[model samples]
Target: MQQQPPTSPDVSSAAKSPLFQSSTQYRNWRFSVEQLKATRAALNQASVAAIRNTFESDSPGSSSDVHFLDANEEHLLVKLYIIKISQLCGHFRFPEEVEATGITYLKRFYLKNTVMDWHPKNVMLTALYLATKTTNHPISLESYTANIPRTNASDVLDLEFLVAQSLAFEFAVWHAHRALWGIWLDIQDLPQAPPHEELQRIHDTAMQHIRTSRLTDVELIYPPSQIALACLSLAHPEIAAFWARSKNADTALEAIESIKRTITRDGDTPSVDVVREIDRHLKICKNPEKVVGSKAYLAKRAREEKEAELKRKKKAENVRKATEQGNPFGEVLVGQANLDDDD
Candidate 1:
């Protein structure tokens, strides 16, 4: 057998674990409080400018009087849709992993994109559809969209690749629910484990908190295991304290406290009215270039197709030059070569 690896003095914190630190979640998706704010604000600003330009170009002075959605409003709208993902999952009888992974994908997509370009309504559906596949919930495309009125297979598929791209194609997510389950199993073997009924209640309550955490920034800020413990701490402080003391994890308890506060502070979804208002503004400010059948979308597609055709023609020219002149890229051969050229 190979030798065991060395660990630090404070090894209880999940964020510091070697396995988790190497995950894409820790490396690519993690962010500080300030960084998350700065990123959203910057993306919102850039999206506003780009959409305004597109509107101006399409219909001069069209967007001059429009009130665009700010970063906070965009976030509220996304939260609204996150809740929708859960409802949809329930409707489809999807597993919690699919729901959670869908939410994570939607969040990651908005980090690198804006709600204006792709409405969260459509993207939420697409993300959940993609999540169903990624999480092994295996619902057919027709079956998935059949019951969702006004949604067709194309509507879900159109943004599927785009969502995948936004997530950097990292579909595997280590979720807090799994961690909480693991912790629950460990709690079973504890010195004075709660009676079966009490332990089950604690597990269920903590699992609810884990679901609530998906509505907050804790998922991006901390590892799943830390979030799980924090949720457990929230559900039943006495049991959490007992578990922590059992493990002699002082620092871990401190971090759990901090994350517990974060979940409590930010976990609740905004009121329906508040989110409804943000969503109302979103329709007016949404990017026309992404709105299918809009003149701007048609124009944008035409331009993209033109550019693609040009690139293809250029490649063909290069191929012809290579075959005829022994050069990868050049004007077509003529003169003596013309005599040998096939009709």
Candidate 2:
């Protein structure tokens, strides 16, 4: 009797959990465009309002002025911080799985708190510490903070619980690495397959794409399987075509397109000027006293202060014109009085 081919396992029962539904349904990890917009807007508004209030309350013509990172600046700073997280993980000799998980934790945490409210450096350290524990590659707090500059055990441990709370203790992160392995295995079983070296190259290239993909919003928008397919598509078009045709070609193609858009949006690579600006701002944010003394910070602050002064003068001029028009509501128009108050 001839041996029979093994049947695929029935995963119907496993489809009932939230993990299975993550690709189709919106989970806590996923964010809509509007949600991202609102979050950034709220952070910017709060920072500006705080700065204005401080300037107004302080003594007249004080040189001290507050500076907050704009949306673009904040985004760049976060990207740099994520890169630092990878470096730190590498220094400790942790596997890529730990690095990916840690970076995801940092990203998700920032979605809840702004860079102003929670410094990215501390959060990055906390996330990595959490990742090491979660991945079963536990490291002592002392050992972890040994080489990291300006950090101690307390810095990591103190924020560890907060980071966990920010993530709602959602430690389970499904990475595209495993999915890439599955695709490689499938390719190996195919007839007329390439030599082992070529197959390894395909696998390596796909892994590289997956690593780069983490620097994008694709992880939040798409599932690991889609990410895996997209990476393979970038690596080997034939493998991607085969994989898509075997599954839902339309859906897979759409996801691949979205990933392509994200990669394009990130651009070929960050320009040197952009990278320098990010570093300058990151240094100021981390060590304001040291960096605020720099000439660049002073020039930037002067420009911002000038803009704020212009806005104030314009507002005053508008109020004066409104009052001269003999409008009873002119005082309220200048935001000086409330019209709703009973006399």
Candidate 3:
């Protein structure tokens, strides 16, 4: 065999190899490198153009002049975020924490980068993988590939390194979910019980809020904690009790408004049309069956229905069994101890 390449004298001392460092040494690496560099350059150019376009219009936030995305484009972008996060959620063994982390990174990455340079799907998987590694679970690239939908596996994997590079390999992301839960708990004065499904729904809704919040400066300025609070505010307005007593609500609300101002000043009151467009794009790229038809989803649904039906059926069953096992008070009262005695 040819001489072996020398290992690092102390394997433990390295700062950890850059992802894809080996691939960079491959013969065709130059082509991939040049392509990525050109892509990054193009994206940077587009970002500049977008900023310039923002200044051209007399009305800052109006749709007439500087716009980030038209209705169709915005919808498409949002949809991509949804699909990416959903798929990541599915892949990393349905770990909600990892899914949340991936979504947070996507939003952050978009704030710095743009839709022009990186496709959302690739960026999404990259975020997921990065999140996984960050959480210390550390699934290998092969496991990711195996979990990915066969059709999109390679494409998703291809973007992993670039995604890492975009985030500068610092992918520690905090979600708004926990912050919201804390607020909810504190305001409600409930004991330290786990959040019920309804509470979980609120968190899920807050997540969607984060997506829309991207249109505002909230993504850029406010911490995730504030964003999570804003999301909770929007999602559970009926919980006036929760907001009224919470001192921090004002701060959270202000962060949201500030984000809205930035977004609007950046362009216009974000059109519902734009939000819808983004939502649609995210949903389309996802495999419906994996989300809706997966065994886990189906099983959960089935269990819920079974439990409900059991409640109804169990009452009757218990009554019937009680009647069978219970003493015959009427017969005892008549002193009919046995058939032979009656005869």
Candidate 4:
């Protein structure tokens, strides 16, 4: 039997409203830790099989010595590209929505597609460009790509549809910053609320935590409000406790701590040395079909062309035989008009 769909990383303690239950994010993208690992491992295995096939077809024994990247290594390279997405957002002065959504898109794309077929560098650029539009921070195609050293409009535009498709066209994202704003407002109206300066400090710190949480899987496994609450918990436990008690402490705290553990455990970026080694191996083992001018690609192309030529010749010969046998489709002789015309 097929494996059961992955459950959420943590069973969310908070309740969901009808509206949230209807959302694509709620219905589609969430995954447990083991599920995510299994998904990546399966994708890596399929890609490695294809890579080996390509090499074996091109020249026997070539793939026997190539070192293929494992699932964890693929993730490290994607992580390196995730950092680059942040720098692109900063350079363009984009809001947090664009940055966060861009990062999410890049991550989700790799979930559906392996990096060996499409490198994250190209996909990251396209994901950010798609993010600018999906988040309502549109930039013209020309202006969007003008600053990059060797990039043009097509470079990003070509991959836009691919990235969107991989995301299942779920462009609406409920970000943590928005949820934090709601909490920030609610905190001020509480009875005997903290001083304005202290509240502001707390919100700022919570915002920092929210940003860090973007690098983790908390967003996928939890809703925005829960993630915001968790960020608040990280920023100041007492304030978070007060806010939770003012609302409903039991359910809120459970979610807050669950998110906290995930954020704290997996929030760090992977080491560059690890990623660099993986990228080096990637060059050697990437699918040859995607590499233009590679031996496998050229051989595959030549075979296709030869097949097309033979098919064309076969079609023409059949037509010639049909005409020679006086089929209705035979060419008309110029000198012999229709027999009926002689009357």
Candidate 5:
């Protein structure tokens, strides 16, 4: 027999490296700082344009109009929705990974489409549904929608495909939870590691920080490993020394500090009244009924639909007329000539 080539490395080790790789190929979810800024800018611009269009159409000469939600307010609305997503995940008894993935999807979806066009309530549920499927924690549409008030299977399922398409089908989310675990193991291997109980405290605190970090833009601007290290630093001051010893200590510390500031700045949850107001707006967007100006909006939409129907009928009539003028291929191709015929 011919001599065999050099044996390849074991499959286990081969898989391990890729699992930890933070490069673009392994971690497509990672984005540059500029990209994050651009996403926010685009969302703001679209929102302003949409609001202006609505105002212009409603009152053509009104020059004293303001945006419905300024940038800060819009950001607050997004945070509130993420909180709602977490609550839903908890109610369903889903794991932390599912919650993180769902929140990630919700954030990503908003980057491309504003709340005006796509209501976050429906998108939140759809994101959770998609997250469950992607993470191998499958839940049926019926079961998922049963507990959600004023929602049904179609509400979630109908938007599932659209959400996936919006994300470009890149569903591989590397959450900070895994990085937290990896850091914990690294500490365990250190020569001067803390006691088991202390280590557990650190781990639990870091996990909590990771959960809170989900409400910020840290996920989009920083890698999961950095986020995990940052959380660990916050949980245990000693971890700062470990980060300081790393090759990219300066950069890593900057990112960690940045994330810490975000966490600190937004530590206080929105008040119940604020949350209720945001929820009311989201509900109105989802179902315009019972809301002010809904009647005018509905009437305008009806007129537009009627106009569209007339245009469609006129196009069909033109096609029919063309096909009847001795054009052998036109009849079959344009007019469904053989659609009703049976061999």
Candidate 6:
């Protein structure tokens, strides 16, 4: 008999080990982080290329009217979007594994699906529902539907099947929050220490940026850890520069030097002093809702009721037509009606 070759351990077993997992997982992740090395890079590159192109081509002079939210506005909306998505992911009955998987799903889905086409809330619900099913998290349709925000709840239920089928049942995901904690702890033990205050800021800001990774195509190609690192690298510049400098004092300036190169290459890096400008922009968006009075809220509700009435009437007409033609179950409808009342 010929000599038998050795059998390797299963992939799942290796994944169970801490050491073999992180690097392997990071390397396997998608999209380039370097694409949006700075705030401006997103404007010119694929980061927001779809929206920018749409506005620019649709009407040559209308780019100004399209309202490209400044970096601060972008950051705020993206951060808020992530929080809601995270909350929805938490509703799933899965363990930490499934929640992590859902976050990745949100990131990947938004990379291609914009806030313009699919509101973040709807997408968030859809991703979580899909994730729960993919991981076999034991959530029932009724339970899931009940937990959704009352506004877009039905729309989410409507698209639940499509999102799940599109994801192809891969529900496993890794998260940056854990990885950021790991990196923070790892850096603390280094021979040359990083400042505690700086590390905390970096961690917080990185988490914020990671939330927006969903707004970019980068999610599909990169691992959560790398996304965290990229965000950290961008958010907390001094820490990264210090680490790079300490590695080779002769090239102590190398880390900072590389940042300069990154800026030059990207051509979209915000000016060196963008933090103040970003802060101002955030204040404007967060100021106040225009509909503050009880009357305004009531009016909004009435408008929504009227819209719903119109939809109901249209649906009745369609259903009557279908029945007259010998169709049943109203099964021919393929589009999801936008129920914007929830937002």
Q: What is the C-alpha lDDT of each candidate?
A: 0.88, 0.73, 0.55, 0.85, 0.75, 0.53
Q: TM-score: which is higher, 3 or 6? A: 3
> Backbone collision count in every prediction?
0, 0, 12, 0, 0, 6
Best-fitting candidate, scored by TM-score: 1
Give candidate 6's error at residue 339 in angstroms: 41
What would you estimate as the lDDT of candidate 1?
0.88
Off by more than 4 A, model 6: 5-103, 110-121, 132-143, 151-157, 194-202, 221-223, 242-343
All candidates: CA RMSD (Å): 6.6, 15.4, 26.0, 10.9, 6.0, 12.3
Q: Number of the top candidate by lDDT?
A: 1
Give the distance in Å from residue 171's predicted Cα in candidate 6 to where it truly belongs. 2.5
Q: Write the per-residue lDDT of candidate 4 for residues 118-225, one digit (tens) a residue.
A: 899889999999989999999998887887668988779878888999999998877888989998899999885789998899999999889878877777778888
- Candidate 6, position 177, lDDT: 59
Task: Score residue 209 of candidate 1 by CA lDDT.
Answer: 96
**Candidate 2 residue 181 C-alpha distance from true site, Å:** 2.1
C-alpha TM-scores of all predictions: 0.88, 0.70, 0.46, 0.81, 0.74, 0.43
> What tens digits encode model 2's per-residue C-alpha lDDT throughout 1-343?
9887885676766766656466322456766556776776777667546544444444344324434567666666677778888788778889988999998898888776666546778889999989988888898888788889888888788788989998888888878887788878877876645899998998898888887887776777777777888888888878777767665575687668777667547624445688677666544343221234654446558878899888878877865787777767655565753343322
Clashing pairs in 2: none
Ranking by TM-score: 1, 4, 5, 2, 3, 6
In the range 1-343, model 1's lDDT, one tens digit per residue, is 8886786665577655678777888889999989999999999999999999999998899998898999998898898889999999888888889999999999999999999888898899999999988988888899888989999999999999999999999988989999889888989999889899999999999999998999998888888988988999999987787777887875788888889988889888789998888878888999999888999999999999999888878866865765765644344443433554222
Which ten contiguous residues of candidate 5 have the minimum total lDDT?
A: 283-292
Q: Please state the error at residue 115 of candidate 6 in Å.
A: 8.7
Per-residue lDDT for 167-208 in model 5, tens only? 879887888888889878878777667899988988999999
Q: lDDT score, residue 315, model 5?
A: 70
The local lDDT score (0 to 100) that residue 202 gets in candidate 2 is 87
Ranking by lDDT: 1, 4, 5, 2, 3, 6
